[model samples]
Target: MAILVTGGAGYIGSHIVRAFRLAGLDPVVVDDLSSGHREFVPDDVPLIELNIVRTKKLTEALRDHSIEAVVHLAGFKYAGVSVQRPLHTYQQNVQGTVSLLRAMAEHDIDKIVFSSSAAVYGTPDVDLVTERTATHPESPYGESKLVGEWVIAAQGRATGLRHTSLRYFNVVGSATDELYDSSPHNLFPLVIRALTEGHRPKIFGDDYPTPDGTCVRDYVHVADLADAHVVATQKLLAGQELEPVYNLGSGDGVSVRQIMTAVARATGIDFEPVVAPRRPGDPARIVASGQLAARDLSWTMRHTLDEMVESAWNARHQS
Candidate 1:
């Protein structure tokens, strides 16, 4: 049975596809190509170009590919933009998840690995966020992801579906030259683009009460994140006990100023970042401990900050 990777043409999804193949598992891709690049998927892998919101096509693909489980990664993932487009965000993240769940239920594909987000913690006051943190989401994107979790949990309760959601922090770096983070809203891309375009990268606010007076966020390597997903899927398939949710985070976080410095060092572009006012709803610090994930999913920050920056820079230039 093949593993269905929704949004497999995307950055993280593409990496997961490669990881699955490396583990000797067949992976069938389903992507709409909205933000994903077709070239990212391997030529040998079967790519089904369709939106997950289309229940009929999704169900057909699931059955046709003999999919045993799904890695759900297709969704509108911009949190700040989601605030302005709440309905669209809900329709894509929440309703799209509902459609996927319906198809999974119809086809008797009872196992799923959901791609959740750390945004659900909204501006946490805690020093280190854990799975037990209160989920007071601040944006429609976060709320929709939280709702997606609830949808999966509810399905599990009603239909005995085996499921687990992986809440990702600020994901960066690349595992391969063929794939890189392409999200326009992501910091790595933004910095790389700015340097390539000969523009000074802008830092939101540098006056926050952090050690460097900038916001601190957990930045995990993309390869590390992908490895956790593969391990989680393996555990579910083997019917091993697993947590309903796990956080893939770096125990120690890097500050925005630190990121700027790293980018300069990696790209060999030394230019002062334009200090702009802090964006509304920006938190001073939000880091998480991946102890639980480490214990169960073989999660670890295998790449150092310098390694992450260098890999991302090289990939960006290669692309």
Candidate 2:
């Protein structure tokens, strides 16, 4: 039986697929190729081109691949755009999660590592968020992820499904040049794209309550993030119990201005970023402790801020 990765052709998902392969585990991919690239998937790995919402096809693929566990990373991932397209967000994230759960139930594939987001906390009141932090999702994307977590938890309680949700903050950097982040909405890609195209990157809001005015977010390397998923999946499949949720964070906050400066330093391109009004549903700051993940999944910040910027810059150029 092989492990299944939903949305495995996407940037982060592809990295996780690489991690699993490095660990000597076989992984089958199921991606619709909507936002994901068909080439991102390794040639040796099986790629099932289907959306998770198509429960029947997904179930068939699960059965065909003899899938033992699922690392679910598929969903609508844009937090800013989710505000304008709440219905689409819910349909993709919430309904998609429900359909995946149903398919898993049919196949008795009880193990799952859900790809959650820090948006579940919305604009947190705490300086450092923990698993115990109350959820107050501001955008439909955030709301849908929180609801997905709820649904998964409910399924676990009802069916004894072994599961865990990883609430990650801003995911950046890359493990390989061939598998760079391709999301047009992500900050790293946006900045890299702007600079490459001879345009100054724009900061969404600079008047926030952050130290540098721009928003403060917890950034974690995508490679490190992917490793944690593999570890989580291994532990779950081994019949080890895990926390219902864990935050994969660095326990440090970096503002948007800091990121831009790092980008300039890494790329040797110095240009002032244009300051624009804050996007709706944006928070001034939100960082997490990652203490739980560190203890359980051996999660740690293996890459520095400059390293993150440099690696991302290198990968984008090589790709």
Candidate 3:
């Protein structure tokens, strides 16, 4: 039985697809290509170019591919921008998720791994967030994701659907040069683009209470995150008991200043990052404990900060 990866042509989704393939699993892709690149998907994999919002077509594809599971990663995922485009965010994330769940039920595909976000926690009050952190999403994007989790839980309770949602902080680095992150809003891409254009990268704030006086946030390597997804899929298929949600995080986080230094070291760009006022609603720090995922999904930080910067820089330059 094959796994259906919605938005499998996108950055993180593409990485998960490659991980599945490397693990000798068949992964069928269905993407609308809204922000996904067709080239990211391997030529051998079946690519069904359809939107998950199209429930009928989505269900048809699941049945046609004989799919037994799904990895749902298709959604509009920009928290700040979601403030301006709330309707779009809700439609793509909430409505689209509902449609996907309905399709799964219709096709009797009960296993799934959802790509959720740390945004669901908003500005967490504690130093380290856990799976039990109170969800008080500050933006439409985050609210949509939390709502998506609820929808999945509701379906699981009613239909015996086995599901898990992986909530992650900043996802960085690349497994392959050809599959680098292309999100316009991601910090790595933004920094890399600025440096490549001979512009100074900007740091939003440096007066936070952290030791470095900058915001400290978890930044996990994309490959590590993909591996967790693969493991989660395997566990579900084997009927292993699992948590409804897991945070794939860096228990210790890196500060923005540290990231700037890493960028300079990796790209050989020697310029101080310009400091700006913190964006509204920006948290001072948000790190998560990944002990649960580590025990269950073999999660670990395999890349150093330097490695993450180097890999991202190399891919940015290569692309």
Candidate 4:
């Protein structure tokens, strides 16, 4: 039986596709190609070009592929843009999830690893966020992810579906030069774009309570995050019980200023970042503890900050 990967043509999704392949699993892709690149998916893999909300098409693809499990990553991913386009966000994230679940139920495809976001915690109150932390999402994107988890959990209870939701922190770096993040709203890509184009990278807020006067966040390498998904899917397929949720985090916080410094060192560029006013609802600091994932899924932060920046820089240039 093949594994289905939603949004397998996108940045993070593409990495998960590679990870699954490295583990000797067959993966089929379903993506709208709205924000994902067609070439990111390997030519050997079957690609069904369609949105997840197209229930009829998705159901047909599931049956045709003999899909036994799914790694769900397709959705509206821009948290900042989600605020301005709440309706569009819900249509893509919430409705899209509902449709995928419907298709899975029809085909008896019972295993799924949800690609969730730290946004669900919305500037969490604690220093180290855990699965028990209360959710208070501040953006439509975050709310949609949290809702997706709820829907998946409810389906699991009703249908005996084996599933787990992985709440990701800042996902950066690249596993290969062939695939790199192209999101205009993400930090790593934005900074890389600016430096390559001979522009100063901008730091939105520099007056936060962080030690360096910038927003502190938990950043994890994209490749590491993808490996966790593979492990989760394997356990679920093996009839092993897993937690309903896990935080794929670094357990340590890295300030934006430190990122800028790391970029300068990596790229051999020396320019002060342009500090702008803080965005509304911006949290001063939000890091997470990946202890649960580490214990269950072998989650680990295998890359240093410098390595993350350097790898991202090299991939952007080489691709």
Candidate 5:
């Protein structure tokens, strides 16, 4: 039996695939490579360059590899972009998730680990967001993710399929020396792209309620996030009590300027930032208390902001 990962060629999915390989498990990859790079997957891991929406091809891949469980990471994620193309986002994220679940059911492969997001919890009245926080997503992207989680929950409850939804904030940094960091949407690489290339990074929305008046977000390293996936899988494989939702984050929130400062310190480029208006539907603060993950999965973030930025910088420019 093998583990099949959708979007395995993408940033987070690739790292998770790396973790699975490191843990002595082979993962079959199915990615259309729309945004994911083909080079992300290793030579040994078989890659099926197919979209999840294509039910016929997906089912064949599952049966061919004897797939036991799936890590669903195939979806678009950009708040502003989603707002512009809400219809496209819904069809891709929501419809695609539903199709994957149905395909898994048909193939008799039930176990699944979903890659959820903190965006599900919009700017709540509560500063620190927990899993119990009302999922009042302001953007279509968040709503699509929430819907995806619901699909997993409803399917798991209805069927014998066991599922764990890992809802966390931004995915940062790379594991190992492969220099696995590159996404236009993520801030770290964008900042590094600007600084190393002698351009000023733009800080969107400078006057938020945060201390630095930018946006504050829960940043978790990619390796730590991958570790949680492995631990979560082990828990389910060991027949441990199932947790519907467990967050993965550094408990501490990092602001925009704070990140820039770290970048400046690490790269020795104390450059002025270009400030811009905030994107619509952006939350002022988002911090996570990953105690539940710590208790259950023995998961903890091992990398600091400096480590994250420094490593990301090295990966983007150095490598």
Candidate 6:
């Protein structure tokens, strides 16, 4: 009954892998050192250094290690990058997911905890969009993720493999340490990086309908987000009929301007951010209501915005 965590060496994947280990579960990891760190995974867990895109190698590793369930996280995720390289995004996210499913079905692994994204809901009309919201993804990255979900759903229906896709927005704060907090794409780290280098944090779209006229997003702490994954996976193991999709957010929407203010409050930095025009394909307000995860997974917010921001700042400085 070993859990096979794909991309376990990456930031969020490493946190989830560490969470599983901390909860008395030994997780086996399969990661190519593409965008992940080999040092992030604990020495105790078995590491099969192989690219999942290489189907034969991934299948060989799965059979060799007797992996029971998989937490699929290995994929390219930069939205702007995906825009430039749509084909690569499709191959990495969509094709990679199909390969994982084929290997799982072949090995008779019936359980999976998928890492879905909130990008599926691109520029929603409502303030707080729920899991039932219509998915009109505007970018190649979002399209790829939505397609990943489709692949899993289609496979799960044909085969009886149970799965739970947790759609997350923003994951901040420290899970293990500050060593893993230097991601270049996410907002929190982006701001911290700019401030650390004595550069102004750039804010896009400061004239929208919101109070600050900037895009808003939900920032869930990594630990609490990890906790949701644990609960979701446990439910699947218990023979529960997974909802197929659920939003894992705080239901509290924080604007970009508000995030800058929070950054200043959390880190005692007074550097102003440069107001830039709205980014291409940027969503104005993309906040998840997160009612389904709360009711079904029995999860709640364990950390505050201030706590999350401060922990992230502390992690940034400590590194």
TM-scores for all candidates: the values are 0.98, 0.97, 0.99, 0.98, 0.95, 0.96
| Model 2 lDDT per residue over 1-319, tens place | 5899998999999999999999999999999999999889999999999989999988887777788899999998998889899999999999999999999999888999999999899888899999999999988999999999999999989999999999989999988888888887889999999999999999998898878899999999999999999999999989998999999988889999999999999998989999988887677888999999999999999999999999999998998
lDDT of 6 by residue, 182-273 (tens): 67788988999899899999998799877778887888888888778777877887787768999998888888888899899988889788
Task: Please write out the lDDT profile of model 4 over residues 1-319, one tens digit for every residue.
Answer: 5899999999999999999999999999999999999999999999999999999988887777889899999999999899899999999999999999999999888999999999999877798999999999989999999999999999999999899999998999999999999999889999999988999999998888889899999999999999999999999999999999999988999999999999999999999999999988888998999999999999999999999999999999999
List candidate 1 stretches off by more than 4 Å: none
Residue 151's lDDT within candidate 3 is 94
Give the lDDT of residue 304 in candidate 4.
96
The TM-score of candidate 4 is: 0.98
For model 1, name the residue pairs that clash. Answer: none
Clashes of 4: 0
Residue-level lDDT of model 3, residues 256-278, one tens digit each, is 99999999999887989999999
RMSD of each: 0.9, 1.3, 0.8, 0.9, 1.5, 1.4
C-alpha lDDT score of every prediction, in listed order: 0.92, 0.93, 0.93, 0.94, 0.85, 0.84
Residues 53-97 of candidate 1 have per-residue lDDT tens digits of 999988887777788989999999899899899999999999899
Number of residue pairs clashing in candidate 2, backbone atoms closer than 3 angstroms, sequence gap of 3 or more or interchain: 0
- Candidate 3 Cα errors over 4 Å, as ranges: none
Q: Which parts of model 5 are misplaced by more than 4 Å?
A: 177-179
What is the full ranking by lDDT, best candidate first?
Answer: 4, 3, 2, 1, 5, 6
Question: Residue pairs in steric clash, candidate 2?
Answer: none
Better of 1 and 2 by lDDT: 2
Lowest lDDT 10-residue stretch of candidate 5: 176-185
**Which candidate do you rate higher for TM-score, 2 or 3?**
3
lDDT of 2 at 108: 85
Whichever of 1 and 3 has more lDDT, that candidate is 3
Which candidate would rank higher by lDDT, 3 or 6?
A: 3
